[model samples]
Target: EPEVTQTPSHQVTQMGQEVILRCVPISNHLYFYWYRQILGQKVEFLVSFYNNEISEKSEIFDDQFSVERPDGSNFTLKIRSTKLEDSAMYFCASSEETLDQPQHFGDGTRLSIL
Candidate 1:
């Protein structure tokens, strides 16, 4: 079966540098989302995108963050300035629909802020 894939499973970054996490969602799915989990916190939704525009976003998605579907198969999340609080597991998910579809998540990109 096809699955979501993420790159650089683990990354260690400086406190103020930029980082881009990459993901490739399931080919036929239309809804994509990004969520982050702090070491001992709940998964927090960052943003959801469909039809090439943002569908919904949470307060966590601030000015320093951005997302893009640079190509037909690749989705990316960019953080302009990393902070210590940014250390967390970033998961990329996709589903056939939002209302009742269960999302499939990648193993995740574990970001470490220094």
Candidate 2:
């Protein structure tokens, strides 16, 4: 089965540096989402995109963040400036239809901001 894949399973960066987290969503899915989980917190939705434009974004997706489908297969999230609070497991997910359907998640890119 096709599955979402994320790069650099773990990443450590200093505060204020830019970081680009990469993912390849399932080939046939139209809805993609980004979510984050702080150490022991519940998963929080960051943003969702479809048709090359943002469909929805949570308050957590502030000015420092942006996402793009750089190619037919790759999706990326860029953080203009990282903060300590940004440390979390950033998960990339995709579903065949909508949020009502179950989403498949990558192992995740663990961003560690220090």
Candidate 3:
């Protein structure tokens, strides 16, 4: 079955550098999201996108972060400047148009900043 997929499963980056985490959601899904798990903390929602526009975003998604659907099949999350506190497991998810549908998540991209 088709599922969400992420690239560069493990990313190690330097502080103040830029990082872009990539994701490919299920082909037919209509809604997309980006979330992060900071070490032992709960998963936090970053943003949601649909029809190439941001549907909603959390306060944690500050000016340093951005999301895009650069093409038909790929969705991406970019951190303009990496910080040590930014280290986390970033997950990409998607769901069908219906709100009741469960969102499918990728294995996640583990980002470690130093």
Candidate 4:
């Protein structure tokens, strides 16, 4: 079965720097999402995108964060002015056709901020 894939499985960055995480969700999925899990914490929803527009976003997704589907197959999450608290395992996910479906997630991009 096809699965989501994230680039740079691990990333180390300085605090206040910018970071862009890349993901390629399942080809046939229609709903895409970005989530993060701080070490030893539960996964938290960040944002969701569908049909080229943002469907929903959580409080954690502030002006500093953005999501884009630059092309047919690539979806990305960009965090501007990264903070130490932003360090977490970022995950990309996709659902077949609706939010009700189970989302398949990538292995995750472990971000480390100093």
Candidate 5:
């Protein structure tokens, strides 16, 4: 079975610094997405990518944040400048065939900004 994989199980960064979170789903997935869960808060959708472009994005994915699939294999989210409020658990997910299929998610990457 194909699954999603994420790098950096945990990260601690200073405010104003930059951090990149990475993910790799199976080769067949046509959709990719990023979500964040602030401690004690519900998970929120950040962005989604498809066909080499952004398919959807939430207000949280502002000018300071960006997502990319630099290679066909790795999906990445970059924070231009970290902020204390950015601390959260980031989840990467993918659906192989279509939205009807269940999304496969990676064990989240926890980001901590000081």
Candidate 6:
């Protein structure tokens, strides 16, 4: 049973600093995604990637956000600038086959922007 792993269990940064969140799914997966949850808000879809390209993205994924699969097993999300409102738990997920398949999620990285 493989799983998705996220780095920097927690991050504390300035409001304007750049942040990179990394995830590694220990399986031959093709679909990857990034989601975020504010402390008291719902889980919001950020972006999805396949074939080394963005397959779907929510409005939340603006010019400030970007996703990349820099390697075969690793996917990353970079925030050009962190805002105080951006503080939340970021989750990385991957599906072995397609978007219709179930996905495995990481423990989530709690980002606190001050």
Superposition error at 49 for model 1 (Å): 0.7
Could you tally the backbone clashes for each prediction? 0, 0, 0, 0, 0, 0
Mark the regions of model 1 whose C-alpha exceeds 4 Å error after superposition.
Answer: none
Model 5 sits at a Cα RMSD from the real structure of 1.1
TM-scores of the candidates in the order shown: 0.97, 0.97, 0.97, 0.97, 0.95, 0.95
Which ranges in model 3 have alpha carbons more than 4 Å from their true place?
Answer: none
Q: Over the stretch 1-114, how does candidate 1's per-residue lDDT look in tens digits?
A: 999999989999999999999999999999999999999999999999998888999999999999999899988899999999999999999999999899999999999999
**lDDT tens digits by residue: candidate 3, 78-97:** 99999999999999999997
C-alpha lDDT of residue 34 in model 2:
95
Error of 3 at 99 (Å): 1.5
Clashing pairs in 4: none
lDDT of each: 0.96, 0.95, 0.96, 0.96, 0.92, 0.92
Error of 2 at 52 (Å): 0.2
Per-residue lDDT of candidate 5, residues 24-51 (tens digit): 9777888999999999999899998888
Given candidate 2, what's the lDDT at residue 50? 93
12-103 in candidate 6: lDDT tens per residue? Answer: 99989999999997578888999999999999999989899999999999999999888777899999889998999999999977736898
